[model samples]
Target: MATDDKTTSHPADPARPGSGDKPGSRAKRAMLGAWFGFFVDLFDIYLPTVALAPAIAYFIAPDLGATGIAITGGMIFTATLIGRPIGAAIFGRFADTVGRKRATIVAMNGAGIATLLMALLPGYHQLGVASVLLFVALRLVGGIFLGGEYTAANPLAMEAAPRHKRGLYSGIINTGFPLAYAAVSLITLLLLLVMPAQGVDSAYAQWGWRIPFVIGAVLAFVLVAYYRRSVDESELFTKQKGTKTPIKTLFSGRNLSAFLQVFALMTGFWLSLQPVAAVLPTLLGADGIGMSSQATTLLLVVAYLLLAAVDVAAAVLSQRIGRRTFLVYAGAVMATVATTVYFLLVRFGPGNPRLAVVCTVLVVIVVVCPWAVLPAYINERFPTSVRASGYGLAYSLAVIVPSFYAFYQAGLGFVMPFNYTGIVLLGVGALTIVGAALAGPETKDIDFRAHADVSA
Candidate 1:
C-alpha cells in the first residue's frame, strides 16, 4: 500500500510531485529495497550448494561415498530447477495482475518461510526416503517464490528509475545476484574453515547447513520491512490502471512482438550465464577439482566479488554507449573467448585454485554484462499502460525455459571435468550476440510516455 503511494508520484516530471525530473532520492530507496530483496532470494537459493556434500554423505549414502554424494546433489539441483518455472509463472502473473510491490512482498515472505523449513528438515538417516522427498518439496516451494522475486523486483526497479540512467539503475539491481553469491561464498568458506572435513559431514547433515537458510529468512523479513517502509507502486502502473484497457490487451499485436524479443534475449542470456556462474562452483567443488573445500570456497568468494565489480562497470558502460550496442559487443566477446577460457581451465586443472578462480571470474565478467542491461531493456519495451505485465510475461517466459539448464548441461558433459562447458558457453554466447544485434533497440533519451511501440 505504501509502495502504491510511492508509485503514484512521477519523480522526474516537474508537474508531478515525484516527477522524473526531480532528484531521485525516492527511486534510490526503492532500488535499495529491491536489491536487498534480490540478495536474500539468491542467498537462500544457493545455500544448498555449499552444503551439498555433507547433505549427501549423511542422507544419500553412508556407504557408496562420492557416487552417492554426486547423485544426491544432482537430484536437489534438478528438483529446484523443475520448480523454478512454476514460481516464475505464478508470481509473474500476480505482479502483472495485482502489483509489483504486493507480489514482491509475498514472494520474499514465502521464500523465507520455505528456507526456514528447509533448515528444520530432518536428515535422511532420521527420516529415510521421506527426508529427501520432504527436502525436495520444501525447495520446490522456495523455488516457486524465488522465480517470481526477480520478475517483480527487476521491473519495479526499472519502472521507478529515471529514464536517462536506466542502464546503471538496472545494472545495480542485477549486481545483487553476484553480491549475494559473494556473501554466501564467504559464509561457506567460514563454515569449511571452522568445521573439519569429518565433522563437516555430521555437523552440516545434522544442522550447520540450516544456518544460511535461517539467515536468509531473517534478511527476507528485513527486506519486506524495507519494501513496506519505502517502495511505492509505479506511477506508470497507476496511470495505466485509470485507463479502461485490460492488462491482457498488451499481449496482442506489436506488443506481442516486443514480448517475443525480450523472451529470446532472456533465454540466450540465462542459458549461457546460469551454467557458468550459478552452477559451476557447486559442480567444481563437489567433483573434487583438486582443491580443498576451504580453497575452493575461497576461490568462489573472490570470483563472485570480481563478478560484482565487473557488473557495475558494465552497467556504467551500457549507459554511456547504449544498452543494445554494449550487449551486442559483450555477448560477442564472451562467445569468442569462452572456448579459450574453458580450455585453459581443463588443461591446468583445479590443481591451482587460483587458475580456476581467474578463469571463472573472466567468464562471469563476459557473461554478466549483457544480462546486466536486461532490466532497463525490458522496462523500456513497454509503455506505462502495461509495463509490469509485459515485462513479467516476457521475462518469466525466458526464465522458465532456462530453468532446466543444470540438468541439460550435465547431460551435455559440461559438468564433467575437462569437458565442453566452454564450448557450450561459446555457442550460447554467439547466439546471444546475434540475438542482441537482431532484436535490441536503443532506448537512450527516449521518453516512456512517447515510445509506446518498443518493437519499432
Candidate 2:
C-alpha cells in the first residue's frame, strides 16, 4: 500500500504521522463518514427551502401581505441560522474534549429526530399561531444538531486524508451540496405533480410538505448508522491529548486571526449563496419572472445536476493549482461574470426559460465553485487541538451577517428595483470573498500537527 498520507495506514504508534504500514481502509472509511455527514446536512436543511416553499401557508397566518409572508417564511431560516453558531460552539468544544466520532453520532441523531417530529406537527388551522411557532422552533433545533455534526465529521476526514488526495476528498464530500439539493427538487417536483399546491384546501399545503421532512429524517438516520458502523476516530486525533477548553484556546493569539480570515470568506460565501440557492426558485416562479412551479423545479433539478459534475471538476482543478489561487479566481468570476449572468437572467428570463436556465447554471457555477477547495483549505488553517472548534465557528458563525439577505434585498429596493437586488448582493459577496482569500495563507500543504500546544 502507499503511505497512509496517500492511501495507506500509519505505523502502530499513534503518535507517529505516517509509515505506510497498512492498506487505506481507515482513510476510505474516514472519507465515507465525512461525505455522509455533509450530504445529510444539506439534504435535511434544504428540504424546507425547496420542498416547503409552496406549502408555507399551512403553518402561518394566511392574511399577511406578500412582504409579510416572505419575512415570516424567512424567519424559519433565520432561526436556523441563529442556532448554527451556538451548536458549533457547543459541539466544537465537545469534539475537541471528547471525540469526533461521538460528537457526530449524537448530532445526527438529534437532527434526525427533530426532522421526523416536524412531519407530525399540527398546522395553523389546528393550533393557530402556535403551530407556526412550533414549526420554526423545531427547525432551529434541527439546524443546531446538523451544525454540530459537520464540525466533528469534516475535521476527522481531513485529518485522515493523505496529503495528495485532500482536494479530491474535499470535492467528493462537497458534492453532497448539489446532489442533495437536486434530490430535494426532484422529490418536491414529483410530490407537487401528485398533490395540488394551490389554495387553502390543497393537499400540499396541508401535509405534502411533511413528506419531504419524513424522507429527510430517514436519510439522516440511515447515513448516521452507516457512519457509526463504518468509520473510526481519526488516527491523528486518537493519538493527541484533548484540549480542556478549545473555544477559549481558539480565540487566543494567532488562532483568532486564522479564524477571522475563514469567517470573512465564509460570510461572503453564505451571502452570495443564499440569494441564488434559497430565494431564486421563489423569484423565478409565481413571484418574479412568472414560471410555473413544475417548470421552476425542473430548472433547479437541471442546474444542480450540472453543478454536481462542475463541483468535482472544480475540485480537481483547485488541486492542480492551489486552493487560495483558485478561490481568488472564482471570486473574481462571481463579481463580474455572475453579476452579468443575473442581469441577463432578469432581463431575458421572463420570455425565455431556456436562457434563464443557462444563466442560472452559469451564476451557480462561478459563485459556488470556491466551495470545492474549502474543506481542505479551512481544515488546514488550524492545528488539531482546536480544529473542530475553530472550523465550526468560522464556518457557521459568519452566517449571521448573511442570514439577513432579505433585509439587504429590501434595503436595495430603495436604490434600485427589487428584482435587481440580487445582482448587487452578489457583487458585495464576491468582493468579500476575494478580499478574504487575498488576506489568508495558502493552506494546500500545511501540517495538521503544527502550530499548537499539544496536550500530554
Superpose all Cα atoms of candidate 1 onto the true structure and report the RMSD in Å to 1 decimal.
Answer: 4.8
**TM-score attained by model 1:** 0.85
CA RMSD for every model?
Answer: 4.8, 3.6
Q: Pick the candidate with the highest lDDT.
A: 2
Model 2 / residue 27 / CA error / Å: 1.6
| Stretch of 10 with least lDDT, candidate 2 | 12-21
Candidate 2 global CA lDDT score: 0.82
Worst 10 residues of 1 by lDDT: 1-10
N/CA/C clash count, model 2:
2
The estimated TM-scores of all candidates read 0.85, 0.91
Taking the tens digit of each residue's C-alpha lDDT, what string does model 1 give over 129-232?
78877887888888778777776777777766666567777777777888888887777667756764364245655666667778888898888888887788
Q: What is the C-alpha lDDT of each candidate?
A: 0.68, 0.82
Q: Write the per-residue lDDT of candidate 2 for residues 96-120, one digit (tens) a residue.
A: 9898888998999999999999889
